[model samples]
Target: MKKIYFLIALFCTVLLHSQERYFLNSDTRLYTSPNTSSAFLGYFRYGAEVRLLSESQNGWYKVQADNFNEGYIQEKFAATRLNAKDVKIKDAENPILEGGDAYYGGNHLFVLVAGLKARALPDKNSKIKEILFTGDPVAVDYVPVNEDDWVNINGNFDEEYARYTLRKFIGLRPNFETLIKDFDNLDVNAVSERKTLSERIVELAWNSEYSKLEPAYQRYYEVVKQINDPKLIAETEMNMALAKGLAKHKLPEQIIAFTKKAEFSLKGTKTKSLYLSQTELVKTFGKPAKKANVGDECGIYLSDLFYYYPDLEVSVDEKKNQAEIVKVYINENNKFIINPNTILDNSVSEKAFIEKYGTYIEASLKSPHNYSIIMEDSQFRLVFKDGKLFSVEIFFYC
Candidate 1:
């Protein structure tokens, strides 16, 4: 065990050592890209140097300067040696442009509206420098970006950004999750048709191959979790489940929906629908009635399996509120349903179901409540009642 662990550690160490770091030249601006046309994140005065984290790629150096976890700069403006003093003069092209406030209007983080391009001189027509993808982080100065407006990246690197796209794109750097959680409160929907852009990006990630999902979804996934709205959470989680199902099981949501006898099959699964799982299924158990006593009147649950709700029902015995046994039934009559309001047929075979859900813990079940199949990092739980499919329940920290 120790030897195996040592090999793993050694391999990781070697991998880390393979990448190289370098220094940026003093008295130049650190643009977000290798080209000179890109928006300058900040000016590195003479004697000011930044850390580079990798070999130059396409004439651009990957950096970790300022508040940025990953950033880019041109090779033309870097020096191999460190400055002995911090007295170097600032450059003119990328002047700090502050009206005398050291904090650049007192804010330190910003973001680019989807598709906003960075310009050479903060002027839209000054020759487009770089194109910022939707949600790309931006660093800037406080002065009003004149092409339309100006923002300031202050900090060791902090800058102000426009909530909506403007001459200069800028805003706060509070992580995607925070921004999205409060999307209903912010006024950043003007650029890139932000609402559409947000959905489009996430949808792309949902459909992307597993290996291709990183860097792309790395942020949005985190954001969706922090959102408080149940509708939004369900929508996002569903997207993620589909993406995972595709990656791990090679079964698209369509097939999954086809296997369930739910209402979603009525219209057919949407092209972007999520692979429904235990989390959504368990939601059907809204509030299990409290049990009164051992054989008390445990009311029977009505069947409501259709379009949105799966075949699910919960029955609890109550002698007046004492307590006994509560039974949750996810009957076989349930159907698989998907979005844009579609319904999957009830004719899907057991083989098709296994293909998407993977092998179960126990090949054969003797009782419904005795077995369950889990998926999505245990976010869902599938209960089998008396050797047959029963109900789905949320199992994660949920």
Candidate 2:
């Protein structure tokens, strides 16, 4: 009995320690106690692994850094997982240097990954110049690429230029303090600047691969929380919540609940509601760009007319005087917004779609030639072609 109790106690201790381990999301100071006023023990860099010594106290975490230096750090600055790909580059408006005539002189990027290698050339096999850690700054010559392309650092080069993967860099350097101050003062310029920054952040989050979507949105959420706008804050919260659900491939019932809670507004189409008459739609959006008889193509007995718009296509049944179905094409000019906050466009990958909406109900038989997938619920259907979102179909019920 005594031996069993001892082994049980040892197992519990090991499990507790394993569950408490976390990584620093940002550079944070280690305090001697849970209070900020307490004496400073040391500082931990981003991506530093630490073990929680105790439960959170007043939003502070009792952490043991380096398995020895026990201290307290703010809970918000720590994450269960490392987010090395959440890097951001300084925008043109907020340049690294105040003045420079050179085109790429002011461009600067932040390293999000710990131990990111800086190679002598663009190739992965090239000699490594140095290893960069999270939050490390690097000035560049031009705008960083969005894909797995490489960019040359400003000063880390010699006869051969030093390069790093561009996908690891975000586009804007957010200054939350300045933004809050400007917002409080009702600065118009600041509002415009922040809008641009927000758009860039949203683009980055939306374009991220399915595997990285959570961290990308999490980083965006952190930025959104600093802004002094209630509407934007609410929208961000909705987006984050929806993203979490989608990333997990939630069930139809759960998705319904999420959509109901979000109460997303339809901004792309002229009509406010999906259940609108042809006359109402025309009154709101004027004449369609093109009108076609699609009844025969659809094999529908009723006389159906398909009205094509820049952002949407509506199939109206003449017998009912109501739209039977509405289709939104996901393209470069993605003006159609079924969900304004969670916009899906051509940039979204098929893998991302599968990850978000779960398995497809139907797929194109002619593979290697023309590939497509169809995922449907009661009201909405998503169609993907060639590993990209092609269109979203909305069905109307009587």
Candidate 3:
């Protein structure tokens, strides 16, 4: 008799534990520690359902909500307005919305926003019935899947191809088939063999150049397919976030810092810095380094390889213990002028040589010519012309 009673009690306990509750409010907040400011776990809208997982001693119950798991909520807030039977829908039928775009709930469609709104009754004209204000939200009654505007929705729903401008949204609905294929093709052990596919996807998106955001989007998609590293993904997504104007602060300095460390680049290789010629400087370290005008006039040729900025003009003059740099003209205008002194040195160090020429070479103090450094760094190359600094090649490694 005791065994029989134990079996009945276990079955009843399991049955009693299987219950769910639907959210009544339009927005439900999930707190990290049953209090605000802990961390936001995501939010749910009206009619969203959750399966009860566990209960806290202090009136807080843990629940498994959509995407979010182990969420805490006060039992007093457990009051739901949705009827139990209405929470779940039959797979055979789905609710449809009547606006340009609509989101589906349990048994209804909710219009997320109203912009150039339209409506179509079953077997009626496709023309819009009425327009709606920008911020208005309305419920959708039926979906017009068979209609012309709704075709290929699951396949192509980008904002550029969207039927209504206001209906477009960021991110696509999760495609199970594509996600499965992505996971299946991934090789956890080797990634170099799969680089071609990722490159192709990224190249195609970049070549389009339709929108400013397309490049970042392509980079993120390729990152998702090629690399499973969460840190890399997070870094790429941060770039995407900045590209989309989602970042609140100015990132110019951060971007410059990030670019300085990049070893490889999709673009050409070049390092930006001002290079001064010894023949052009009249002074060196508290004394005249070289003659500024040996014969007639001082000639300065300013060449911009990548043309990133305008030409900067600097005047040359001899000073005691150093060279004086003053901007005497700009863009053919002799206007701007400021004097700045730079330390003069005769000896070249390995680090300083690389900083100037992008490489280090055996520094030779050749007679007549003070020094000639053969660059070992791969980013720059220089050719001497007429015993002066000739063509300086800069490579920008992205």
Return the top candidate by TM-score.
Answer: 2
* Ranking 1 against 3 by TM-score, winner: 1
Instruction: Look at candidate 2 and tell me the lDDT of residue 394.
Output: 57
In order, candidate lDDTs are 0.40, 0.53, 0.34
Q: Give the winner by lDDT.
A: 2
Give stretches of model 3 more than 4 Å off: 1-15, 24-26, 80-398
Cα-based lDDT at residue 276, candidate 2: 68
* Candidate 1's TM-score: 0.24
Off by over 4 Å in 1: 1-110, 119-130, 135-168, 184-398
Tens digits of per-residue lDDT for model 3, 1-398: 99999888866654454443435333345555676456645443444445455544487656654332356655544544655444432223233222244333332232222133443321125544454332223332112222232211211123232222122311222232343345348775446534433433332222222233334355345646566788667545533433343213224454233223322110121111233443433221222322233221223223211111122222333232222222211122111111122111223332232233321211111121122222222232223333233222333232
Q: What digit string (tens of lDDT, one per residue) describes model 1 on residues 259-378?
A: 233222212222122233323333433333331222223222221112222233222222222211112233334434422343323443333343444322222111213323333333
CA shift at 287, candidate 2, in angstroms?
Answer: 3.1
Q: Under the 3 Å rule for N, CA and C atoms, how many clashes does model 2 have? A: 1
lDDT (Cα, 0-100) at 106 in candidate 3: 33
Greater-TM-score candidate between 2 and 3:
2
lDDT of 1: 0.40
Model 2: residues with Cα > 4 Å off, grouped in runs: 1-249, 258-271, 283-286, 289-303, 309-311, 317-325, 332-341, 356-379, 395-398
